[model samples]
Target: AQSVTQLDSHVSVSEGTPVLLRCNYSSSYSPSLFWYVQHPNKGLQLLLKYTSAATLVKGINGFEAEFKKSETSFHLTKPSAHMSDAAEYFCVVSLGSNDYKLSFGAGTTVTVRA
Candidate 1:
């Protein structure tokens, strides 16, 4: 079994600044983690993912995350924020037992201010 918890419901940042979103997860076996972003009335897009192959993962739109086994955390970060980055983000954990079984976090809404 694998599960993910998003630590924040909302995150606000200024345009052209930095961004951070927190997440925690648990799994019975080694887990695969993912970050997804969704804009209003838009489909979810894969932001990044962490597999056994890499501890650090980078994704499109200057987003990245680091897998920390010691803390059971996979936090998303961006060196600079853009207004277009305003969206809802989800933390996902893959249940290795089942290919279709995936747990999703509630979601964190990111607001970019001018």
Candidate 2:
């Protein structure tokens, strides 16, 4: 089985400050990891993905996450925060099989304060 755990349910950041969202996972196989962002009433956009290829993966909007096999963690980070960065972020893991099922964490809602 493959599963992901997002440590923080919510995160607050001042405009232009750094943003960090923590996540951990456990998988039977080398699962694929992804970070997806969702704006209010908007669909999900892929921020980044790690597929047995890269350890440090960069995504859209100046966001990046490093896959640490030893710690079983993939934490998202951004050097600066913008008001537009306020949204829901989901940490996801793909069950590497034909089912193509995705397991999502509860999600972390980021609030950007001016």
By lDDT, who's the top model here?
2
Every candidate's lDDT: 0.93, 0.96
lDDT of 2 by residue, 44-65 (tens): 9999999978899999999999
lDDT of 2: 0.96
Model 1 per-residue lDDT at 114: 96
In order of appearance, the predictions have TM-scores of 0.96, 0.97
**Candidate 1 lDDT by residue in tens digits, 1-114:** 578899999999999988999999997767999999999999999999888799999999999999999899999999999999999999999887645577899999999999
lDDT of 1 at 2: 75
Deviation from native of the Cα of residue 29 in model 1, angstroms: 2.0
Clashing pairs in 2: none
